[model samples]
Target: MVDALLDIAGLRAGYESTTVLRDIDLRVEEGQLSVVIGPNGHGKTTLLRAISGLVTSSAGRITFAGQDITRMRPEAISARGLVHIPQGDALFPDMTVLENLTLGAFLRRGGRAERSQQLAVVYDIFPRLAERSSQRARTLSGGERRMLALGRGLMADARMLMIDEPSLGLAPVLVDEVYRQIARIAESGMTILLVEENFSRVRDLADRLTLIENGEVRASGTVQEVLADPAVAATYLGIES
Candidate 1:
């Protein structure tokens, strides 16, 4: 956990009366890609939610950039450089792609020049977004929607990004494209925390990983170590534990 930008210790949270994340400990080192991979019903999405403050935490501490944010509001956490892109395309279906991306910086204290600078960077990351700047978000293809979502996160100037399922519904090629863009984003020096079901993609991109099943972390390690354990892989992947 050295150089850790986002740290969670003894984290426990869930919907009312239904515990989801239990004693979860995680770390995302600066400029690293940390992925959480598990099969359906393993609370991957819940973990992301818990980190973003969308779900209330019943216990534990969350520190981001050396500050505690265990009970902060979503907007508060976001402004402090933690951006969460939840599962599914949560775009403003009625708005243009450019409009959606612009909104990501609404909370930022930057002036016009800063806003322009960030927009240019976003276009560099996803030229497709630049091309469809005038197009409504709803009209975009699934892959394009994912791009916009990430682009929006970039505009937020997040120090650490929590992205849930970058390849949820795209074709194989598009999925690869999405994951590639994600990697590119990580390369830009911001830490990334991802929740993904595509085990292949996760293995290819993550610097480290944590396995969560039935609301608890089952394993945590480098890709080779975790994937080699039949019990660990099966417990989270739901094959044969």
Candidate 2:
């Protein structure tokens, strides 16, 4: 059996009085790239937020590496190596690129040399970050900022990385580059749970695909299986299968 690194069953969560996600069930296997694709306002971001403990689940459970983490605090969860790289590339605008990257290792338990080794790995993945290490985060271009955000997450040395819409707000060329980097990351055997608004962006990268519509799981399976589902073809692909 495949080892599931992150599993959610019957999950329900939302802000105050509004319920955004209902009975969502998903699984991301270890060392595989799982993609969740949905339209905007359909609870894609909310799903990630709830998993990372940014939003509390009203019901159901979230399990990571066989541990029940439904009620764990966000920081505590993050410290366990499940890192959430939120959409909008939430970097410290005033901080230098290097400083922001360094902050990602705050929860990591390691000596300086170990941290330096991780930083070197990130730089190797995103050479641009090393080139602009002294530059303020706010001054970098959108693509560069996205790279910094990814590099910062790598600094955490997460066992499972949950990324929210890595291609948001980027030109087509930049989107390609970002996805290329993501593919590279996956090639290195990192477990990734990636969210994307556009299905085309993740179609080739996903080892498994889950389609979410209006805060609920519509279909999930291997990429081909999900894409071949009749309902998915009609509603998502605009073609009747």
Candidate 3:
């Protein structure tokens, strides 16, 4: 039987008096790269925040690896191997690269040897991180900061990853590099739920896509399926044909 890596049903979340996410039902199976795309302020980031437990869900169930974690705290959800890398290079500016990565393994009850193993794996994936291991995070370029953010998430041996806007401030070349890295991560068999505004890139990289609009899911299907619908393109994605 194929086990679902992350399942969200009828999920709803938002800030104080602001209804952000409404009845969102999404699923990401194991070993697949699913992307979520839509126009600005369509609850894409909120969905990721909800899944990571940063934003509280007012309604519905969220199951990761078949366990109910709808109301779990952020730390608890993270410890369960569901890591989220938010849009803004959320790195501690003054912290050293190694210090930031070390924090990722803080929940693990493992010693130096285990941490060392994980760091090696992360460095293998992002050599820039290894090169600047002792430098402060703020000293790195924008793309490098993003890479470190993702590398830190991998240090958890995450079963599934939810990343928001991997291409936000990157140059064209850097965008392609980021996409390549994301594809590489998925190629290694990890499930990824990526929320991106870069539709052209998502269209090419996403195996499946779910479009959100006005805090609800307006369309969900394969990339081609969602992109082919004129209504979905115009209303949800704000893409003019």
Candidate 1 ranges beyond 4 A from true positions: 1-3, 233-241
RMSD of 2: 1.2
lDDT of 3 by residue, 1-241 (tens): 4667888899989998898999989888888899988887879999999898898898999999999999999989988889999887888899999999998788765788999998998888888899999999999988889899998888885888899999998988888887888888888888899998767887777888998878888889997788689987776566788
On residues 1-241, what C-alpha lDDT tens digit does candidate 2 reach at each position? 6668898999999999999999999988899899988778999999999999999999999999999999999999999999999998899999999999999998888899999999999999998889999999999999999999998999995998999998889999999999999999999999999999788788788999988999999889998898677878678855566
- Provide the lDDT at 28 for model 1: 83
User: What C-alpha RMSD separates each model from the true structure?
Assistant: 1.9, 1.2, 1.9
lDDT of 3 at 61: 96
Predicted candidate 1 versus true structure: per-residue lDDT over 108-190, tens digit per residue: 77798998899999999899999999999999999999999999998996788899998887899999899888888888887
Q: How do the predictions measure up, each by TM-score?
A: 0.94, 0.97, 0.93
Q: Whole-model lDDT, candidate 1? A: 0.88
Cα deviation in Å at residue 168, candidate 1?
A: 0.9
Best by lDDT: 2
Q: What is the number of residue pairs that collide in model 2?
A: 0
> Over all chains combined, what TM-score does candidate 2 have?
0.97
Q: Candidate 1, residue 83: CA error in Å?
A: 0.1
Pairs with steric clashes in candidate 3:
none
* Ranking of candidates on TM-score, top first: 2, 1, 3
